[model samples]
Target: MTDTLERPVDAEPGRMNTRPAWLALFGAIAAFASAALIWICRAGDPSVHYVSQLGATGMPTAPLFNLALLLLAVAAVLVDRATIARGAGYVVGWPVATTLLVCGLCFGVASVITCSPGCPVPFTPGSLVQDFVHISFAVLGFVLAIVAMGQVAALRRRPWMRAASIITLVAVGATSLTGAMIALFKGDTVLGGNLEFTAATLAIAWFGVFGLQVFADHRTARRRAARSHE
Candidate 1:
């Protein structure tokens, strides 16, 4: 009886597990650690120099920063795969998976094609084509994260997740918008840099939290299934 009851939860192939959650957490920690190392290695005013500048070509921190992005990309990809394994019951499933895939791609592209020194805005004076590409993809990645958050917010079955996603969507959207406006209008000032970093940190942390939620939801579903069988 116990075996029969537990079969649905334990025997299912490709069920969302703890690995992806741990990967997400590790990725977030690595990104923050790399950023801290970059700051320590290169003394620059965070307000004036954007985060991308730390990872720009020729900077001492470039390798570490780029590696961090790659880790993040991997984490996103793994999370997307786990989400897909949840099957059709997941609300906005395809959209969330697609957005995560695109976000991962963007992060990978940005890691490989780092910007020039100063990380100038796209199409501005002294900005290289690669700079334009890097910035565009990075911005798109964050925007897509916001999209995914909105989609997750629609998960009515998961009230905690819905509420958390809504809050994150608002906070990340506000910070990203403010930073983007400052970058576009006034160039990279201290305020813009701070806001940009804030948005990124929030987004990355949310991703980690998202992984935890996925794990919790899966466990809860399994337990409920077992109880129903009993």
Candidate 2:
């Protein structure tokens, strides 16, 4: 007798299901759009960075931007769950999910706790705790996003997904780096802000592309299944 191997019902020989990718894309778009709106609304202020503006107490629109971040976080978690359901192992899925969840929670918390006066300035001896928490989440969320991108790139078997993962990694990296530079060295507000915005745009664009790819894959799979039935 010969030993037999079993494959998952939805598993394709060389491809992973892309449904999750689409979800992630949606989340990315929502987050990106929200961030863009926030930036545009605050562009007039010569003294404020996008990150700082997000939590600034005086900014009436801060809550809306924070809401966007929360939505993005939710989308990230959904993407992770979808990937797992499609048969990517526990190892690949959990970290992504956890990171996204953490990011989401952080955003949700930060949204309600608007920062005190002089927020973008480094937290000094008397800076409010809310400002510290807000900054922490902003930095950590981007860092985790970078990690999730790398994880997705490594675990996904599809060529397009892998490619998107790489692009996302680069975009997130640039965004994170620029954000850090702005925080640490207090770099040129205009240039750093622009670069951060560009990087974020690239990341969102990749999410949209990934979603399209996954949708295309879903269509292709359906066609193949139909042919096989015939």
Candidate 3:
């Protein structure tokens, strides 16, 4: 118990290792996949309305996928804890490292919502706003992920991370532009489609990478802490 509290102080101040990062990353990938699948399952029509009803009582395979999402969230939490252990700045008003932790809850809740035996009844076209809300949370979380990554990248001075940061910054720019383009060209389905796709994908993938990094780093920090205490 004593060891658990102090373990974070033992890591390379703000550095996280690589092994566990992939684990959480795979989990993050699963999270996006599950969210997409669940959305498709509920989608009465991708264009206008998304039906909440899953058609059948329950999908047998869904259980496994939902579990996968849950696992990814746990992995994310572990990583977030590690960032905190390393004294990684939260950035802005909130702690950036903790965003990954919050995303775990978001993904878990989304999974549970998907797991319900029946989809939401009387699906309204207006529910598109709900979808937007989900996207907003994801975006907010991803922004924080970048903050954490920046800290890690700064501490390590890794070239790959530098490249990743540059790409991510561009993604952030393009994502916002795409989202606006989607709203602007509501009539022109072609451009809107491309914009939405680009923005949403970048947002999901960014969060996904951050989630994995947090999981790997935090777990390693814990191990190092225990060793130091011994």
Q: RMSD of each candidate?
A: 4.9, 5.4, 7.9
- Measured on C-alpha atoms, candidate 3 has an lDDT of 0.49
If both were scored by lDDT, which would come out higher, candidate 2 or candidate 3? 2
Q: Which ten residues in a row have the lowest lDDT in candidate 1?
A: 1-10
Ranking by lDDT: 1, 2, 3
Per residue, candidate 2 scores C-alpha lDDT tens digits across 12-110 of 655545565466556556555655665655564545555556447776655666665565556555554543343433245465556556655655565
Q: In lDDT terms, how accurate is model 2?
A: 0.58
Between candidates 1 and 3, the lDDT winner: 1
> How do the residues 1-230 of candidate 1 rate in per-residue lDDT, one tens digit apiece?
22321233333343424453344445445444544554553454343357788788887778877876776677567667656545554447464767888998998898899999888877879999999899888888878888888888886766787898999899988987898899779876788877877777777766766766655555665656656656
Tell how far residue 27 is off in model 1, in angstroms.
6.6
**Clashes in model 1: which pairs?**
47-190
Per model, state how many residue pairs clash: 1, 0, 7
Q: Write one digit per residue (lDDT tens) for candidate 3, span 1-230.
A: 22442346444544534444455556566546644654453343344211222321265445554554455456456555544544533333455556667766665554454523433222434344444434444445445545544544443333565467567767756755665665555555546544545544454555566555555555665566556656
| Candidate 3 positional error at 226, Å | 12
lDDT of 3 at 108: 54
